[model samples]
Target: MRWTWIDRFVRLEPGRRATAVKNLSWAEDYFADHFPGYPVMPAPLILEGLAQTGGILVGHVHQYRKNVILAKMTARFHAEAHPGQQITYTVELLDLNEAGARVRGTATVHDKLLAEADIMFAHVGPEQLPAELADPQFVFSGELAHLLRQAESVISASSSSPPSAVTS
Candidate 1:
């Protein structure tokens, strides 16, 4: 079964950055018997959310041809998330190339940082996402590719130097 986790995206972007929101609740199956009376959102799950957001950014930037995979992470949890709390995750790419992309992101609740990480993704074609996700009819991929191209255009324009040579 496709993990329902991917469906929880509240904010997703194809390029530049992506935001994801996860609402902690008692209804979650994982919380049911995790700790009985002292339940909390699992740390690993929080990291995955952040990773997913970053992965989406990388995949879109490369047009999904460079299969992006989570290569590594350096994550630190600063606070505990409780039931009913909403976690907002934002990821921004620091650098990107043919081989991989580096991103830094945070998950917060009420302006408090719950977790932060520097995540990396290695690029490969069709390997970044399963075949089911590679379909052209997929709305997310199409929308993301458009946005990513727009962002690239802006960056290219900003980086070009104005006419340098002077006419006689």
Candidate 2:
């Protein structure tokens, strides 16, 4: 299943970094059983949120030609987030190459850090992808479209390619 945990991009610097936000709501599906009386966002989901932010940064570098999958992560959680909290996830690219890239990120509420991680990704280009994902463009078309719309509306980074290049 393809699930994008981060809600929207607050900032996106191509090949450098990105910051996204996720406003937790009481209506979220998982809250019903996550703790019953003491509802809190799951740690794993938070990690995924951070990973998605880094993924978008890496994707911008590859020109949407690769599937930047999470290969490794060393994450630390310092606090729990309730439904009403809004998390700002910040991800910075540390290095990039034909093979993949490395990133460091943090999820924060207010000015305090709630969690952080150093994540590694494998940049599987179109030629290297499995048959199910051979069409790299379509594989990420939906996400790229949403992100592209967000990016164009916010920063007007005209140097980047438009999402419409990919057909439905």
Candidate 3:
């Protein structure tokens, strides 16, 4: 099964940055096995969210023609995130080239920092893979591809809507 770590993309800027969110819930399967009563979101999952956010940003740069794979990541967690909290992941492109791309990301809950990471994604070409695994759409197929469409819709909707009036 394909698991999407992010709920939705709030902002996406090709070759620049991306922002996405995930709402934690008690119903998540991991909570049942991860410490039972004191359900805390796994650190790896949090990192995955960041990577997904960054990965999408990198993929969008090439219009998803290239396979963007998470090659390396270094992260630090400052606090635990629990069910009912919302995690906001923001990633900025630090560097990008034919080889790959690097992103600096952060996860925050209600404006408080939860984790930060530096993630690297490798762009794999069809020729680099074995013939059996040389599907051009291998990485960005199905759910992951759907996410890009969803992000575009969100961006369109927000752009078309009138801005809300500010109140003192």
Please report the candidate that would top TM-score against the real structure.
Answer: 3
| Residue-level lDDT tens digits of model 1 in 102-130 | 89999999799999999988765554456
The lDDT, on a scale of 0 to 1, for candidate 2 is: 0.81
lDDT of 2 by residue, 10-107 (tens): 88867667889999999988888898988999999999999988987887775666778889999999999889999999998888877888999999
lDDT of each: 0.68, 0.81, 0.86
Error of 3 at 155 (Å): 4.1
> TM-score of predicted model 1?
0.69
List, residue by residue over 1-168, the lDDT tens digit for candidate 3: 758999999887656678999999999999998887899999999999999999988887778898999999999999999999999999988888888989999999989999999998999998788888746668888777778898776543333332232100
State the weakest 10-residue window (summed lDDT) of model 3. 159-168
How should the candidates be ordered by lDDT, best one leading? 3, 2, 1
Model 1, residue 105: displacement in angstroms?
Answer: 0.3
Q: On a 0 to 100 scale, what is the lDDT of residue 4 in model 1? A: 24
Clashing pairs in 2: none
